[model samples]
Target: MSDFRDVVILLPGITGSVLANAAGKEVWAPSAGAAWRAITSFGSSITGLELAGDDADDGVSAPRLVADVTLVPGLVKIDGYSRIENYLVEHLGLERGANYFPFPYDWRRDNRVSARRLESQAMAWLKTWRERSGNAEARLVLIGHSMGGLVARYFIECLGGWQATRALLTLGTPHRGSLNAVGFLENGMKKGIGPFGLDLSPLLRSLTSVYQLLPIYPCIGTGAGELQRIAAAAEAGLLTHVDAARAHAARAFHQEIQDAQARNARDEAYARNGPTLVPVVGIEQPTVQSVQVKDGRIELLNSHDGSDFGGDGTVPRVSGTPIEMGDAKREVYAAEMHGALQNADGTLANLRGVLTRDRIDFRKFQRAEDAAMLTLDVDDVVLPGDPVAVRVRASEGNPRISVTLTLVATGEAFDEPLARDPEPGWQQGIFDLEPGIWRVTAHAEGATPVSDLVVVAAP
Candidate 1:
């Protein structure tokens, strides 16, 4: 444990931290059984064991305790950023409590609130370390995933976290924002296999964190043309009051980023004195760019081609990879999914390199794209009658690459000139197929062909 050099804090993203009630009951945590109950119990106001801050009327209050959650007995571990914790403890030789800690907060609250709490907790930890270890020179490093990254940034930039922080590293974080939040706001949340799949829409309506994640750029729209402003629809009575609050929060966060960018531009000293900002984002994954809500129906505009506008199933690359300020370094990984970014070998190597100030051999890790890396972006599963969009990209910067999508089950191929959306390398159309396992294969000229198994579930 003493081999650890500096204190490190691991901040989890939305639903990444486990929370318990006053009575020690698991309130919010991962469980296959809990997820099954939530789905089956259709009409209950609250389903499953996720009762985080149930007494709080606003749903943005703090949790009673950041409790430890047990891993499922038999199932293999997958998804979330928890594995990163194990890697740091076991492989990196970091000791829990002594040199490492997990900063778990109520994710539904405003990022500013989380940032404040993080600042307070980190300061306490640093003080204790200085007193006990006699290492007054000891500084702290912050590693945040997804929403946790945003919270850490707020603490460093706004809450004076730079005073004690050595560096700030973010993984798959939406520096700008994510369009998926719009989907949640437009259509109530859909339960997925992971925490993102749990239908938390009813409680999410009052969540400031969700609203803060709305894309800073104009992308989502309604029947009255593209939403010109955040509160445009809500103010016009087209959206509910809950959505109006979300729009208000989204606009506020956008302004905050703009202000931060402007401030950092003028006062060069601000960046010079602050902690080093390192942002590592995932690319080449089909990420939703926009959510069009019309007549109470939602349409997800996903970036199928691995464009800069694309995302890693959650955060768009453009939003995740913001222009760095100060001496901040940015790293991009192709084919790394958002949920698994923290555990990916390439990402972990880059992080270790950054910490040790050593040069990383990129060749050691697998590249999602080769010399002419073919990047394919699409959902892993879709509902019957749902329009499946496919986006393909070549490292040579060719947008018009010859690509073919074949359904293995039915032996159907879509290789002709498909209809394009407003974006490049994007095509969408409905394929009539029975519910079963479907292998979607894409081949690009002069590039390695890639295949992804997609499930076509019954509607």
Candidate 2:
């Protein structure tokens, strides 16, 4: 018999439990005090009837549903709690329990502890489920939201052997930490230190402080501290410091990116790259930038349908997808976000497709061939009149590719084009440009084309 029996585990994001309760859903909201209380009050019920039923195929079987695991910040009342909680409870059939684990609020405060706790909880649950079902081959699926996704990933990486996990799905999790988080942390810290006299509990302070400073950006090590250092240097009129900090963080971020890419390559390197774990899918909202002449005035217009980005308003499309240690695949639904994942309409339908079908839609990665692919490696300082060698690769197709490299110090584009062999391999060209942020564009002869941005240091 196939060891792949369907089983799903739901994990909620930050403040998800409180939101669930305010929504009047059956969620296990455990505060520190409440956990102690539960241990004392329900000591007997702790080992109560093991919730199990017949196999899914059995006519009398009740579909196995377990308690929802919500991440830290317990539960808080927020607007829209009723409608949102009711919808989730009705759809997912969440249960209340007493064994949920809690972690420090600040992700950076102590990642090691947080990661360990999450792994322990997940492993414990898996063990129990496996023992009860007596199925060594049962397929396990994890559904996580926001940071819950990250926790789930850490759990899989730490405790989930290749043979243990079947699939993982994340909604609105910041695999690559979001820039918005930096702002949130900074503001929270300032408030905690100033008005709160830093008297806030360690959990609250950490939630509002420490994790913000570490390099948490998915695959990139550009943490809030690094960004703050850059900002401070820039404010202090230390252009050099700003450049160095930016470069340092970029390199760190690039390392993680490269690592992720390498992992992806390895997964695709062979036919059976381990037990058939498929790609992790994410929903992304559509975004477009446009400028229009309104009443003879050039106006920049940025408009998004409420669901235009894949994230659920908080997480981006890139971060919400599950982290496959192998090949990475993503799907962007034009109008989807965190909450939209369970939509009954086409949104949830797409999710179901990803869950059932092993293939991913590739159109999300498609780019107009006319766009130029630019790659830069600045091993030395970027100074004015520095001899910079830039390499570019452009697709040989209609709307032929044209390249432009600009010096930020002077609003001047190099008078010459970077040598383009239009060959299959790397092509190199030299430019004497001043230090600052450089802009490179690959244009299709007469059409507006795509571009990439790079900052070069002043030598």
- Top TM-score model: 1
Clashes of each: 5, 22
Candidate 1 lDDT tens digits, 1-459: 355566899887876765554555555555666545434443142333232442453333334322233343222133655567777787667778887888888776677877888888899988887777788877789998888888888787666677688888888888777877766666665455543244566666666777888766666467465453446655665445336755776678657755665665466665576567778878888888765567756677774222236667788877776545323444656568776777788888877767776334443344544345566677788787875656665556554454455667678766643345457644433455567766665655455666677777877
Whole-model lDDT for model 1 versus the true structure?
0.66
lDDT of 2 at 9: 54
Q: Which regions of candidate 2 are displaced past 4 Å?
A: 1-6, 18-112, 158-162, 189-205, 208-312, 321-329, 332-334, 337-347, 350-459
> lDDT scores for all predictions?
0.66, 0.40
Per-candidate TM vs. native? Answer: 0.65, 0.41
Please give the distance, in angstroms, between residue 51's alpha carbon in candidate 1 and its true position after superposition: 11
Which stretches of model 1 miss by more than 4 angstroms? 37-78, 190-199, 222-227, 236-242, 257-270, 293-296, 304-308, 323-329, 358-459
Give a tens-digit lDDT track for model 2, residues 376-455.
43334455566666555444333334557776667688544545555554455666655677776655443344456666
List the pairs of residues colliding in candidate 1: 191-197, 192-197, 304-391, 305-391, 370-373
Question: CA lDDT of 212 in candidate 2?
Answer: 23
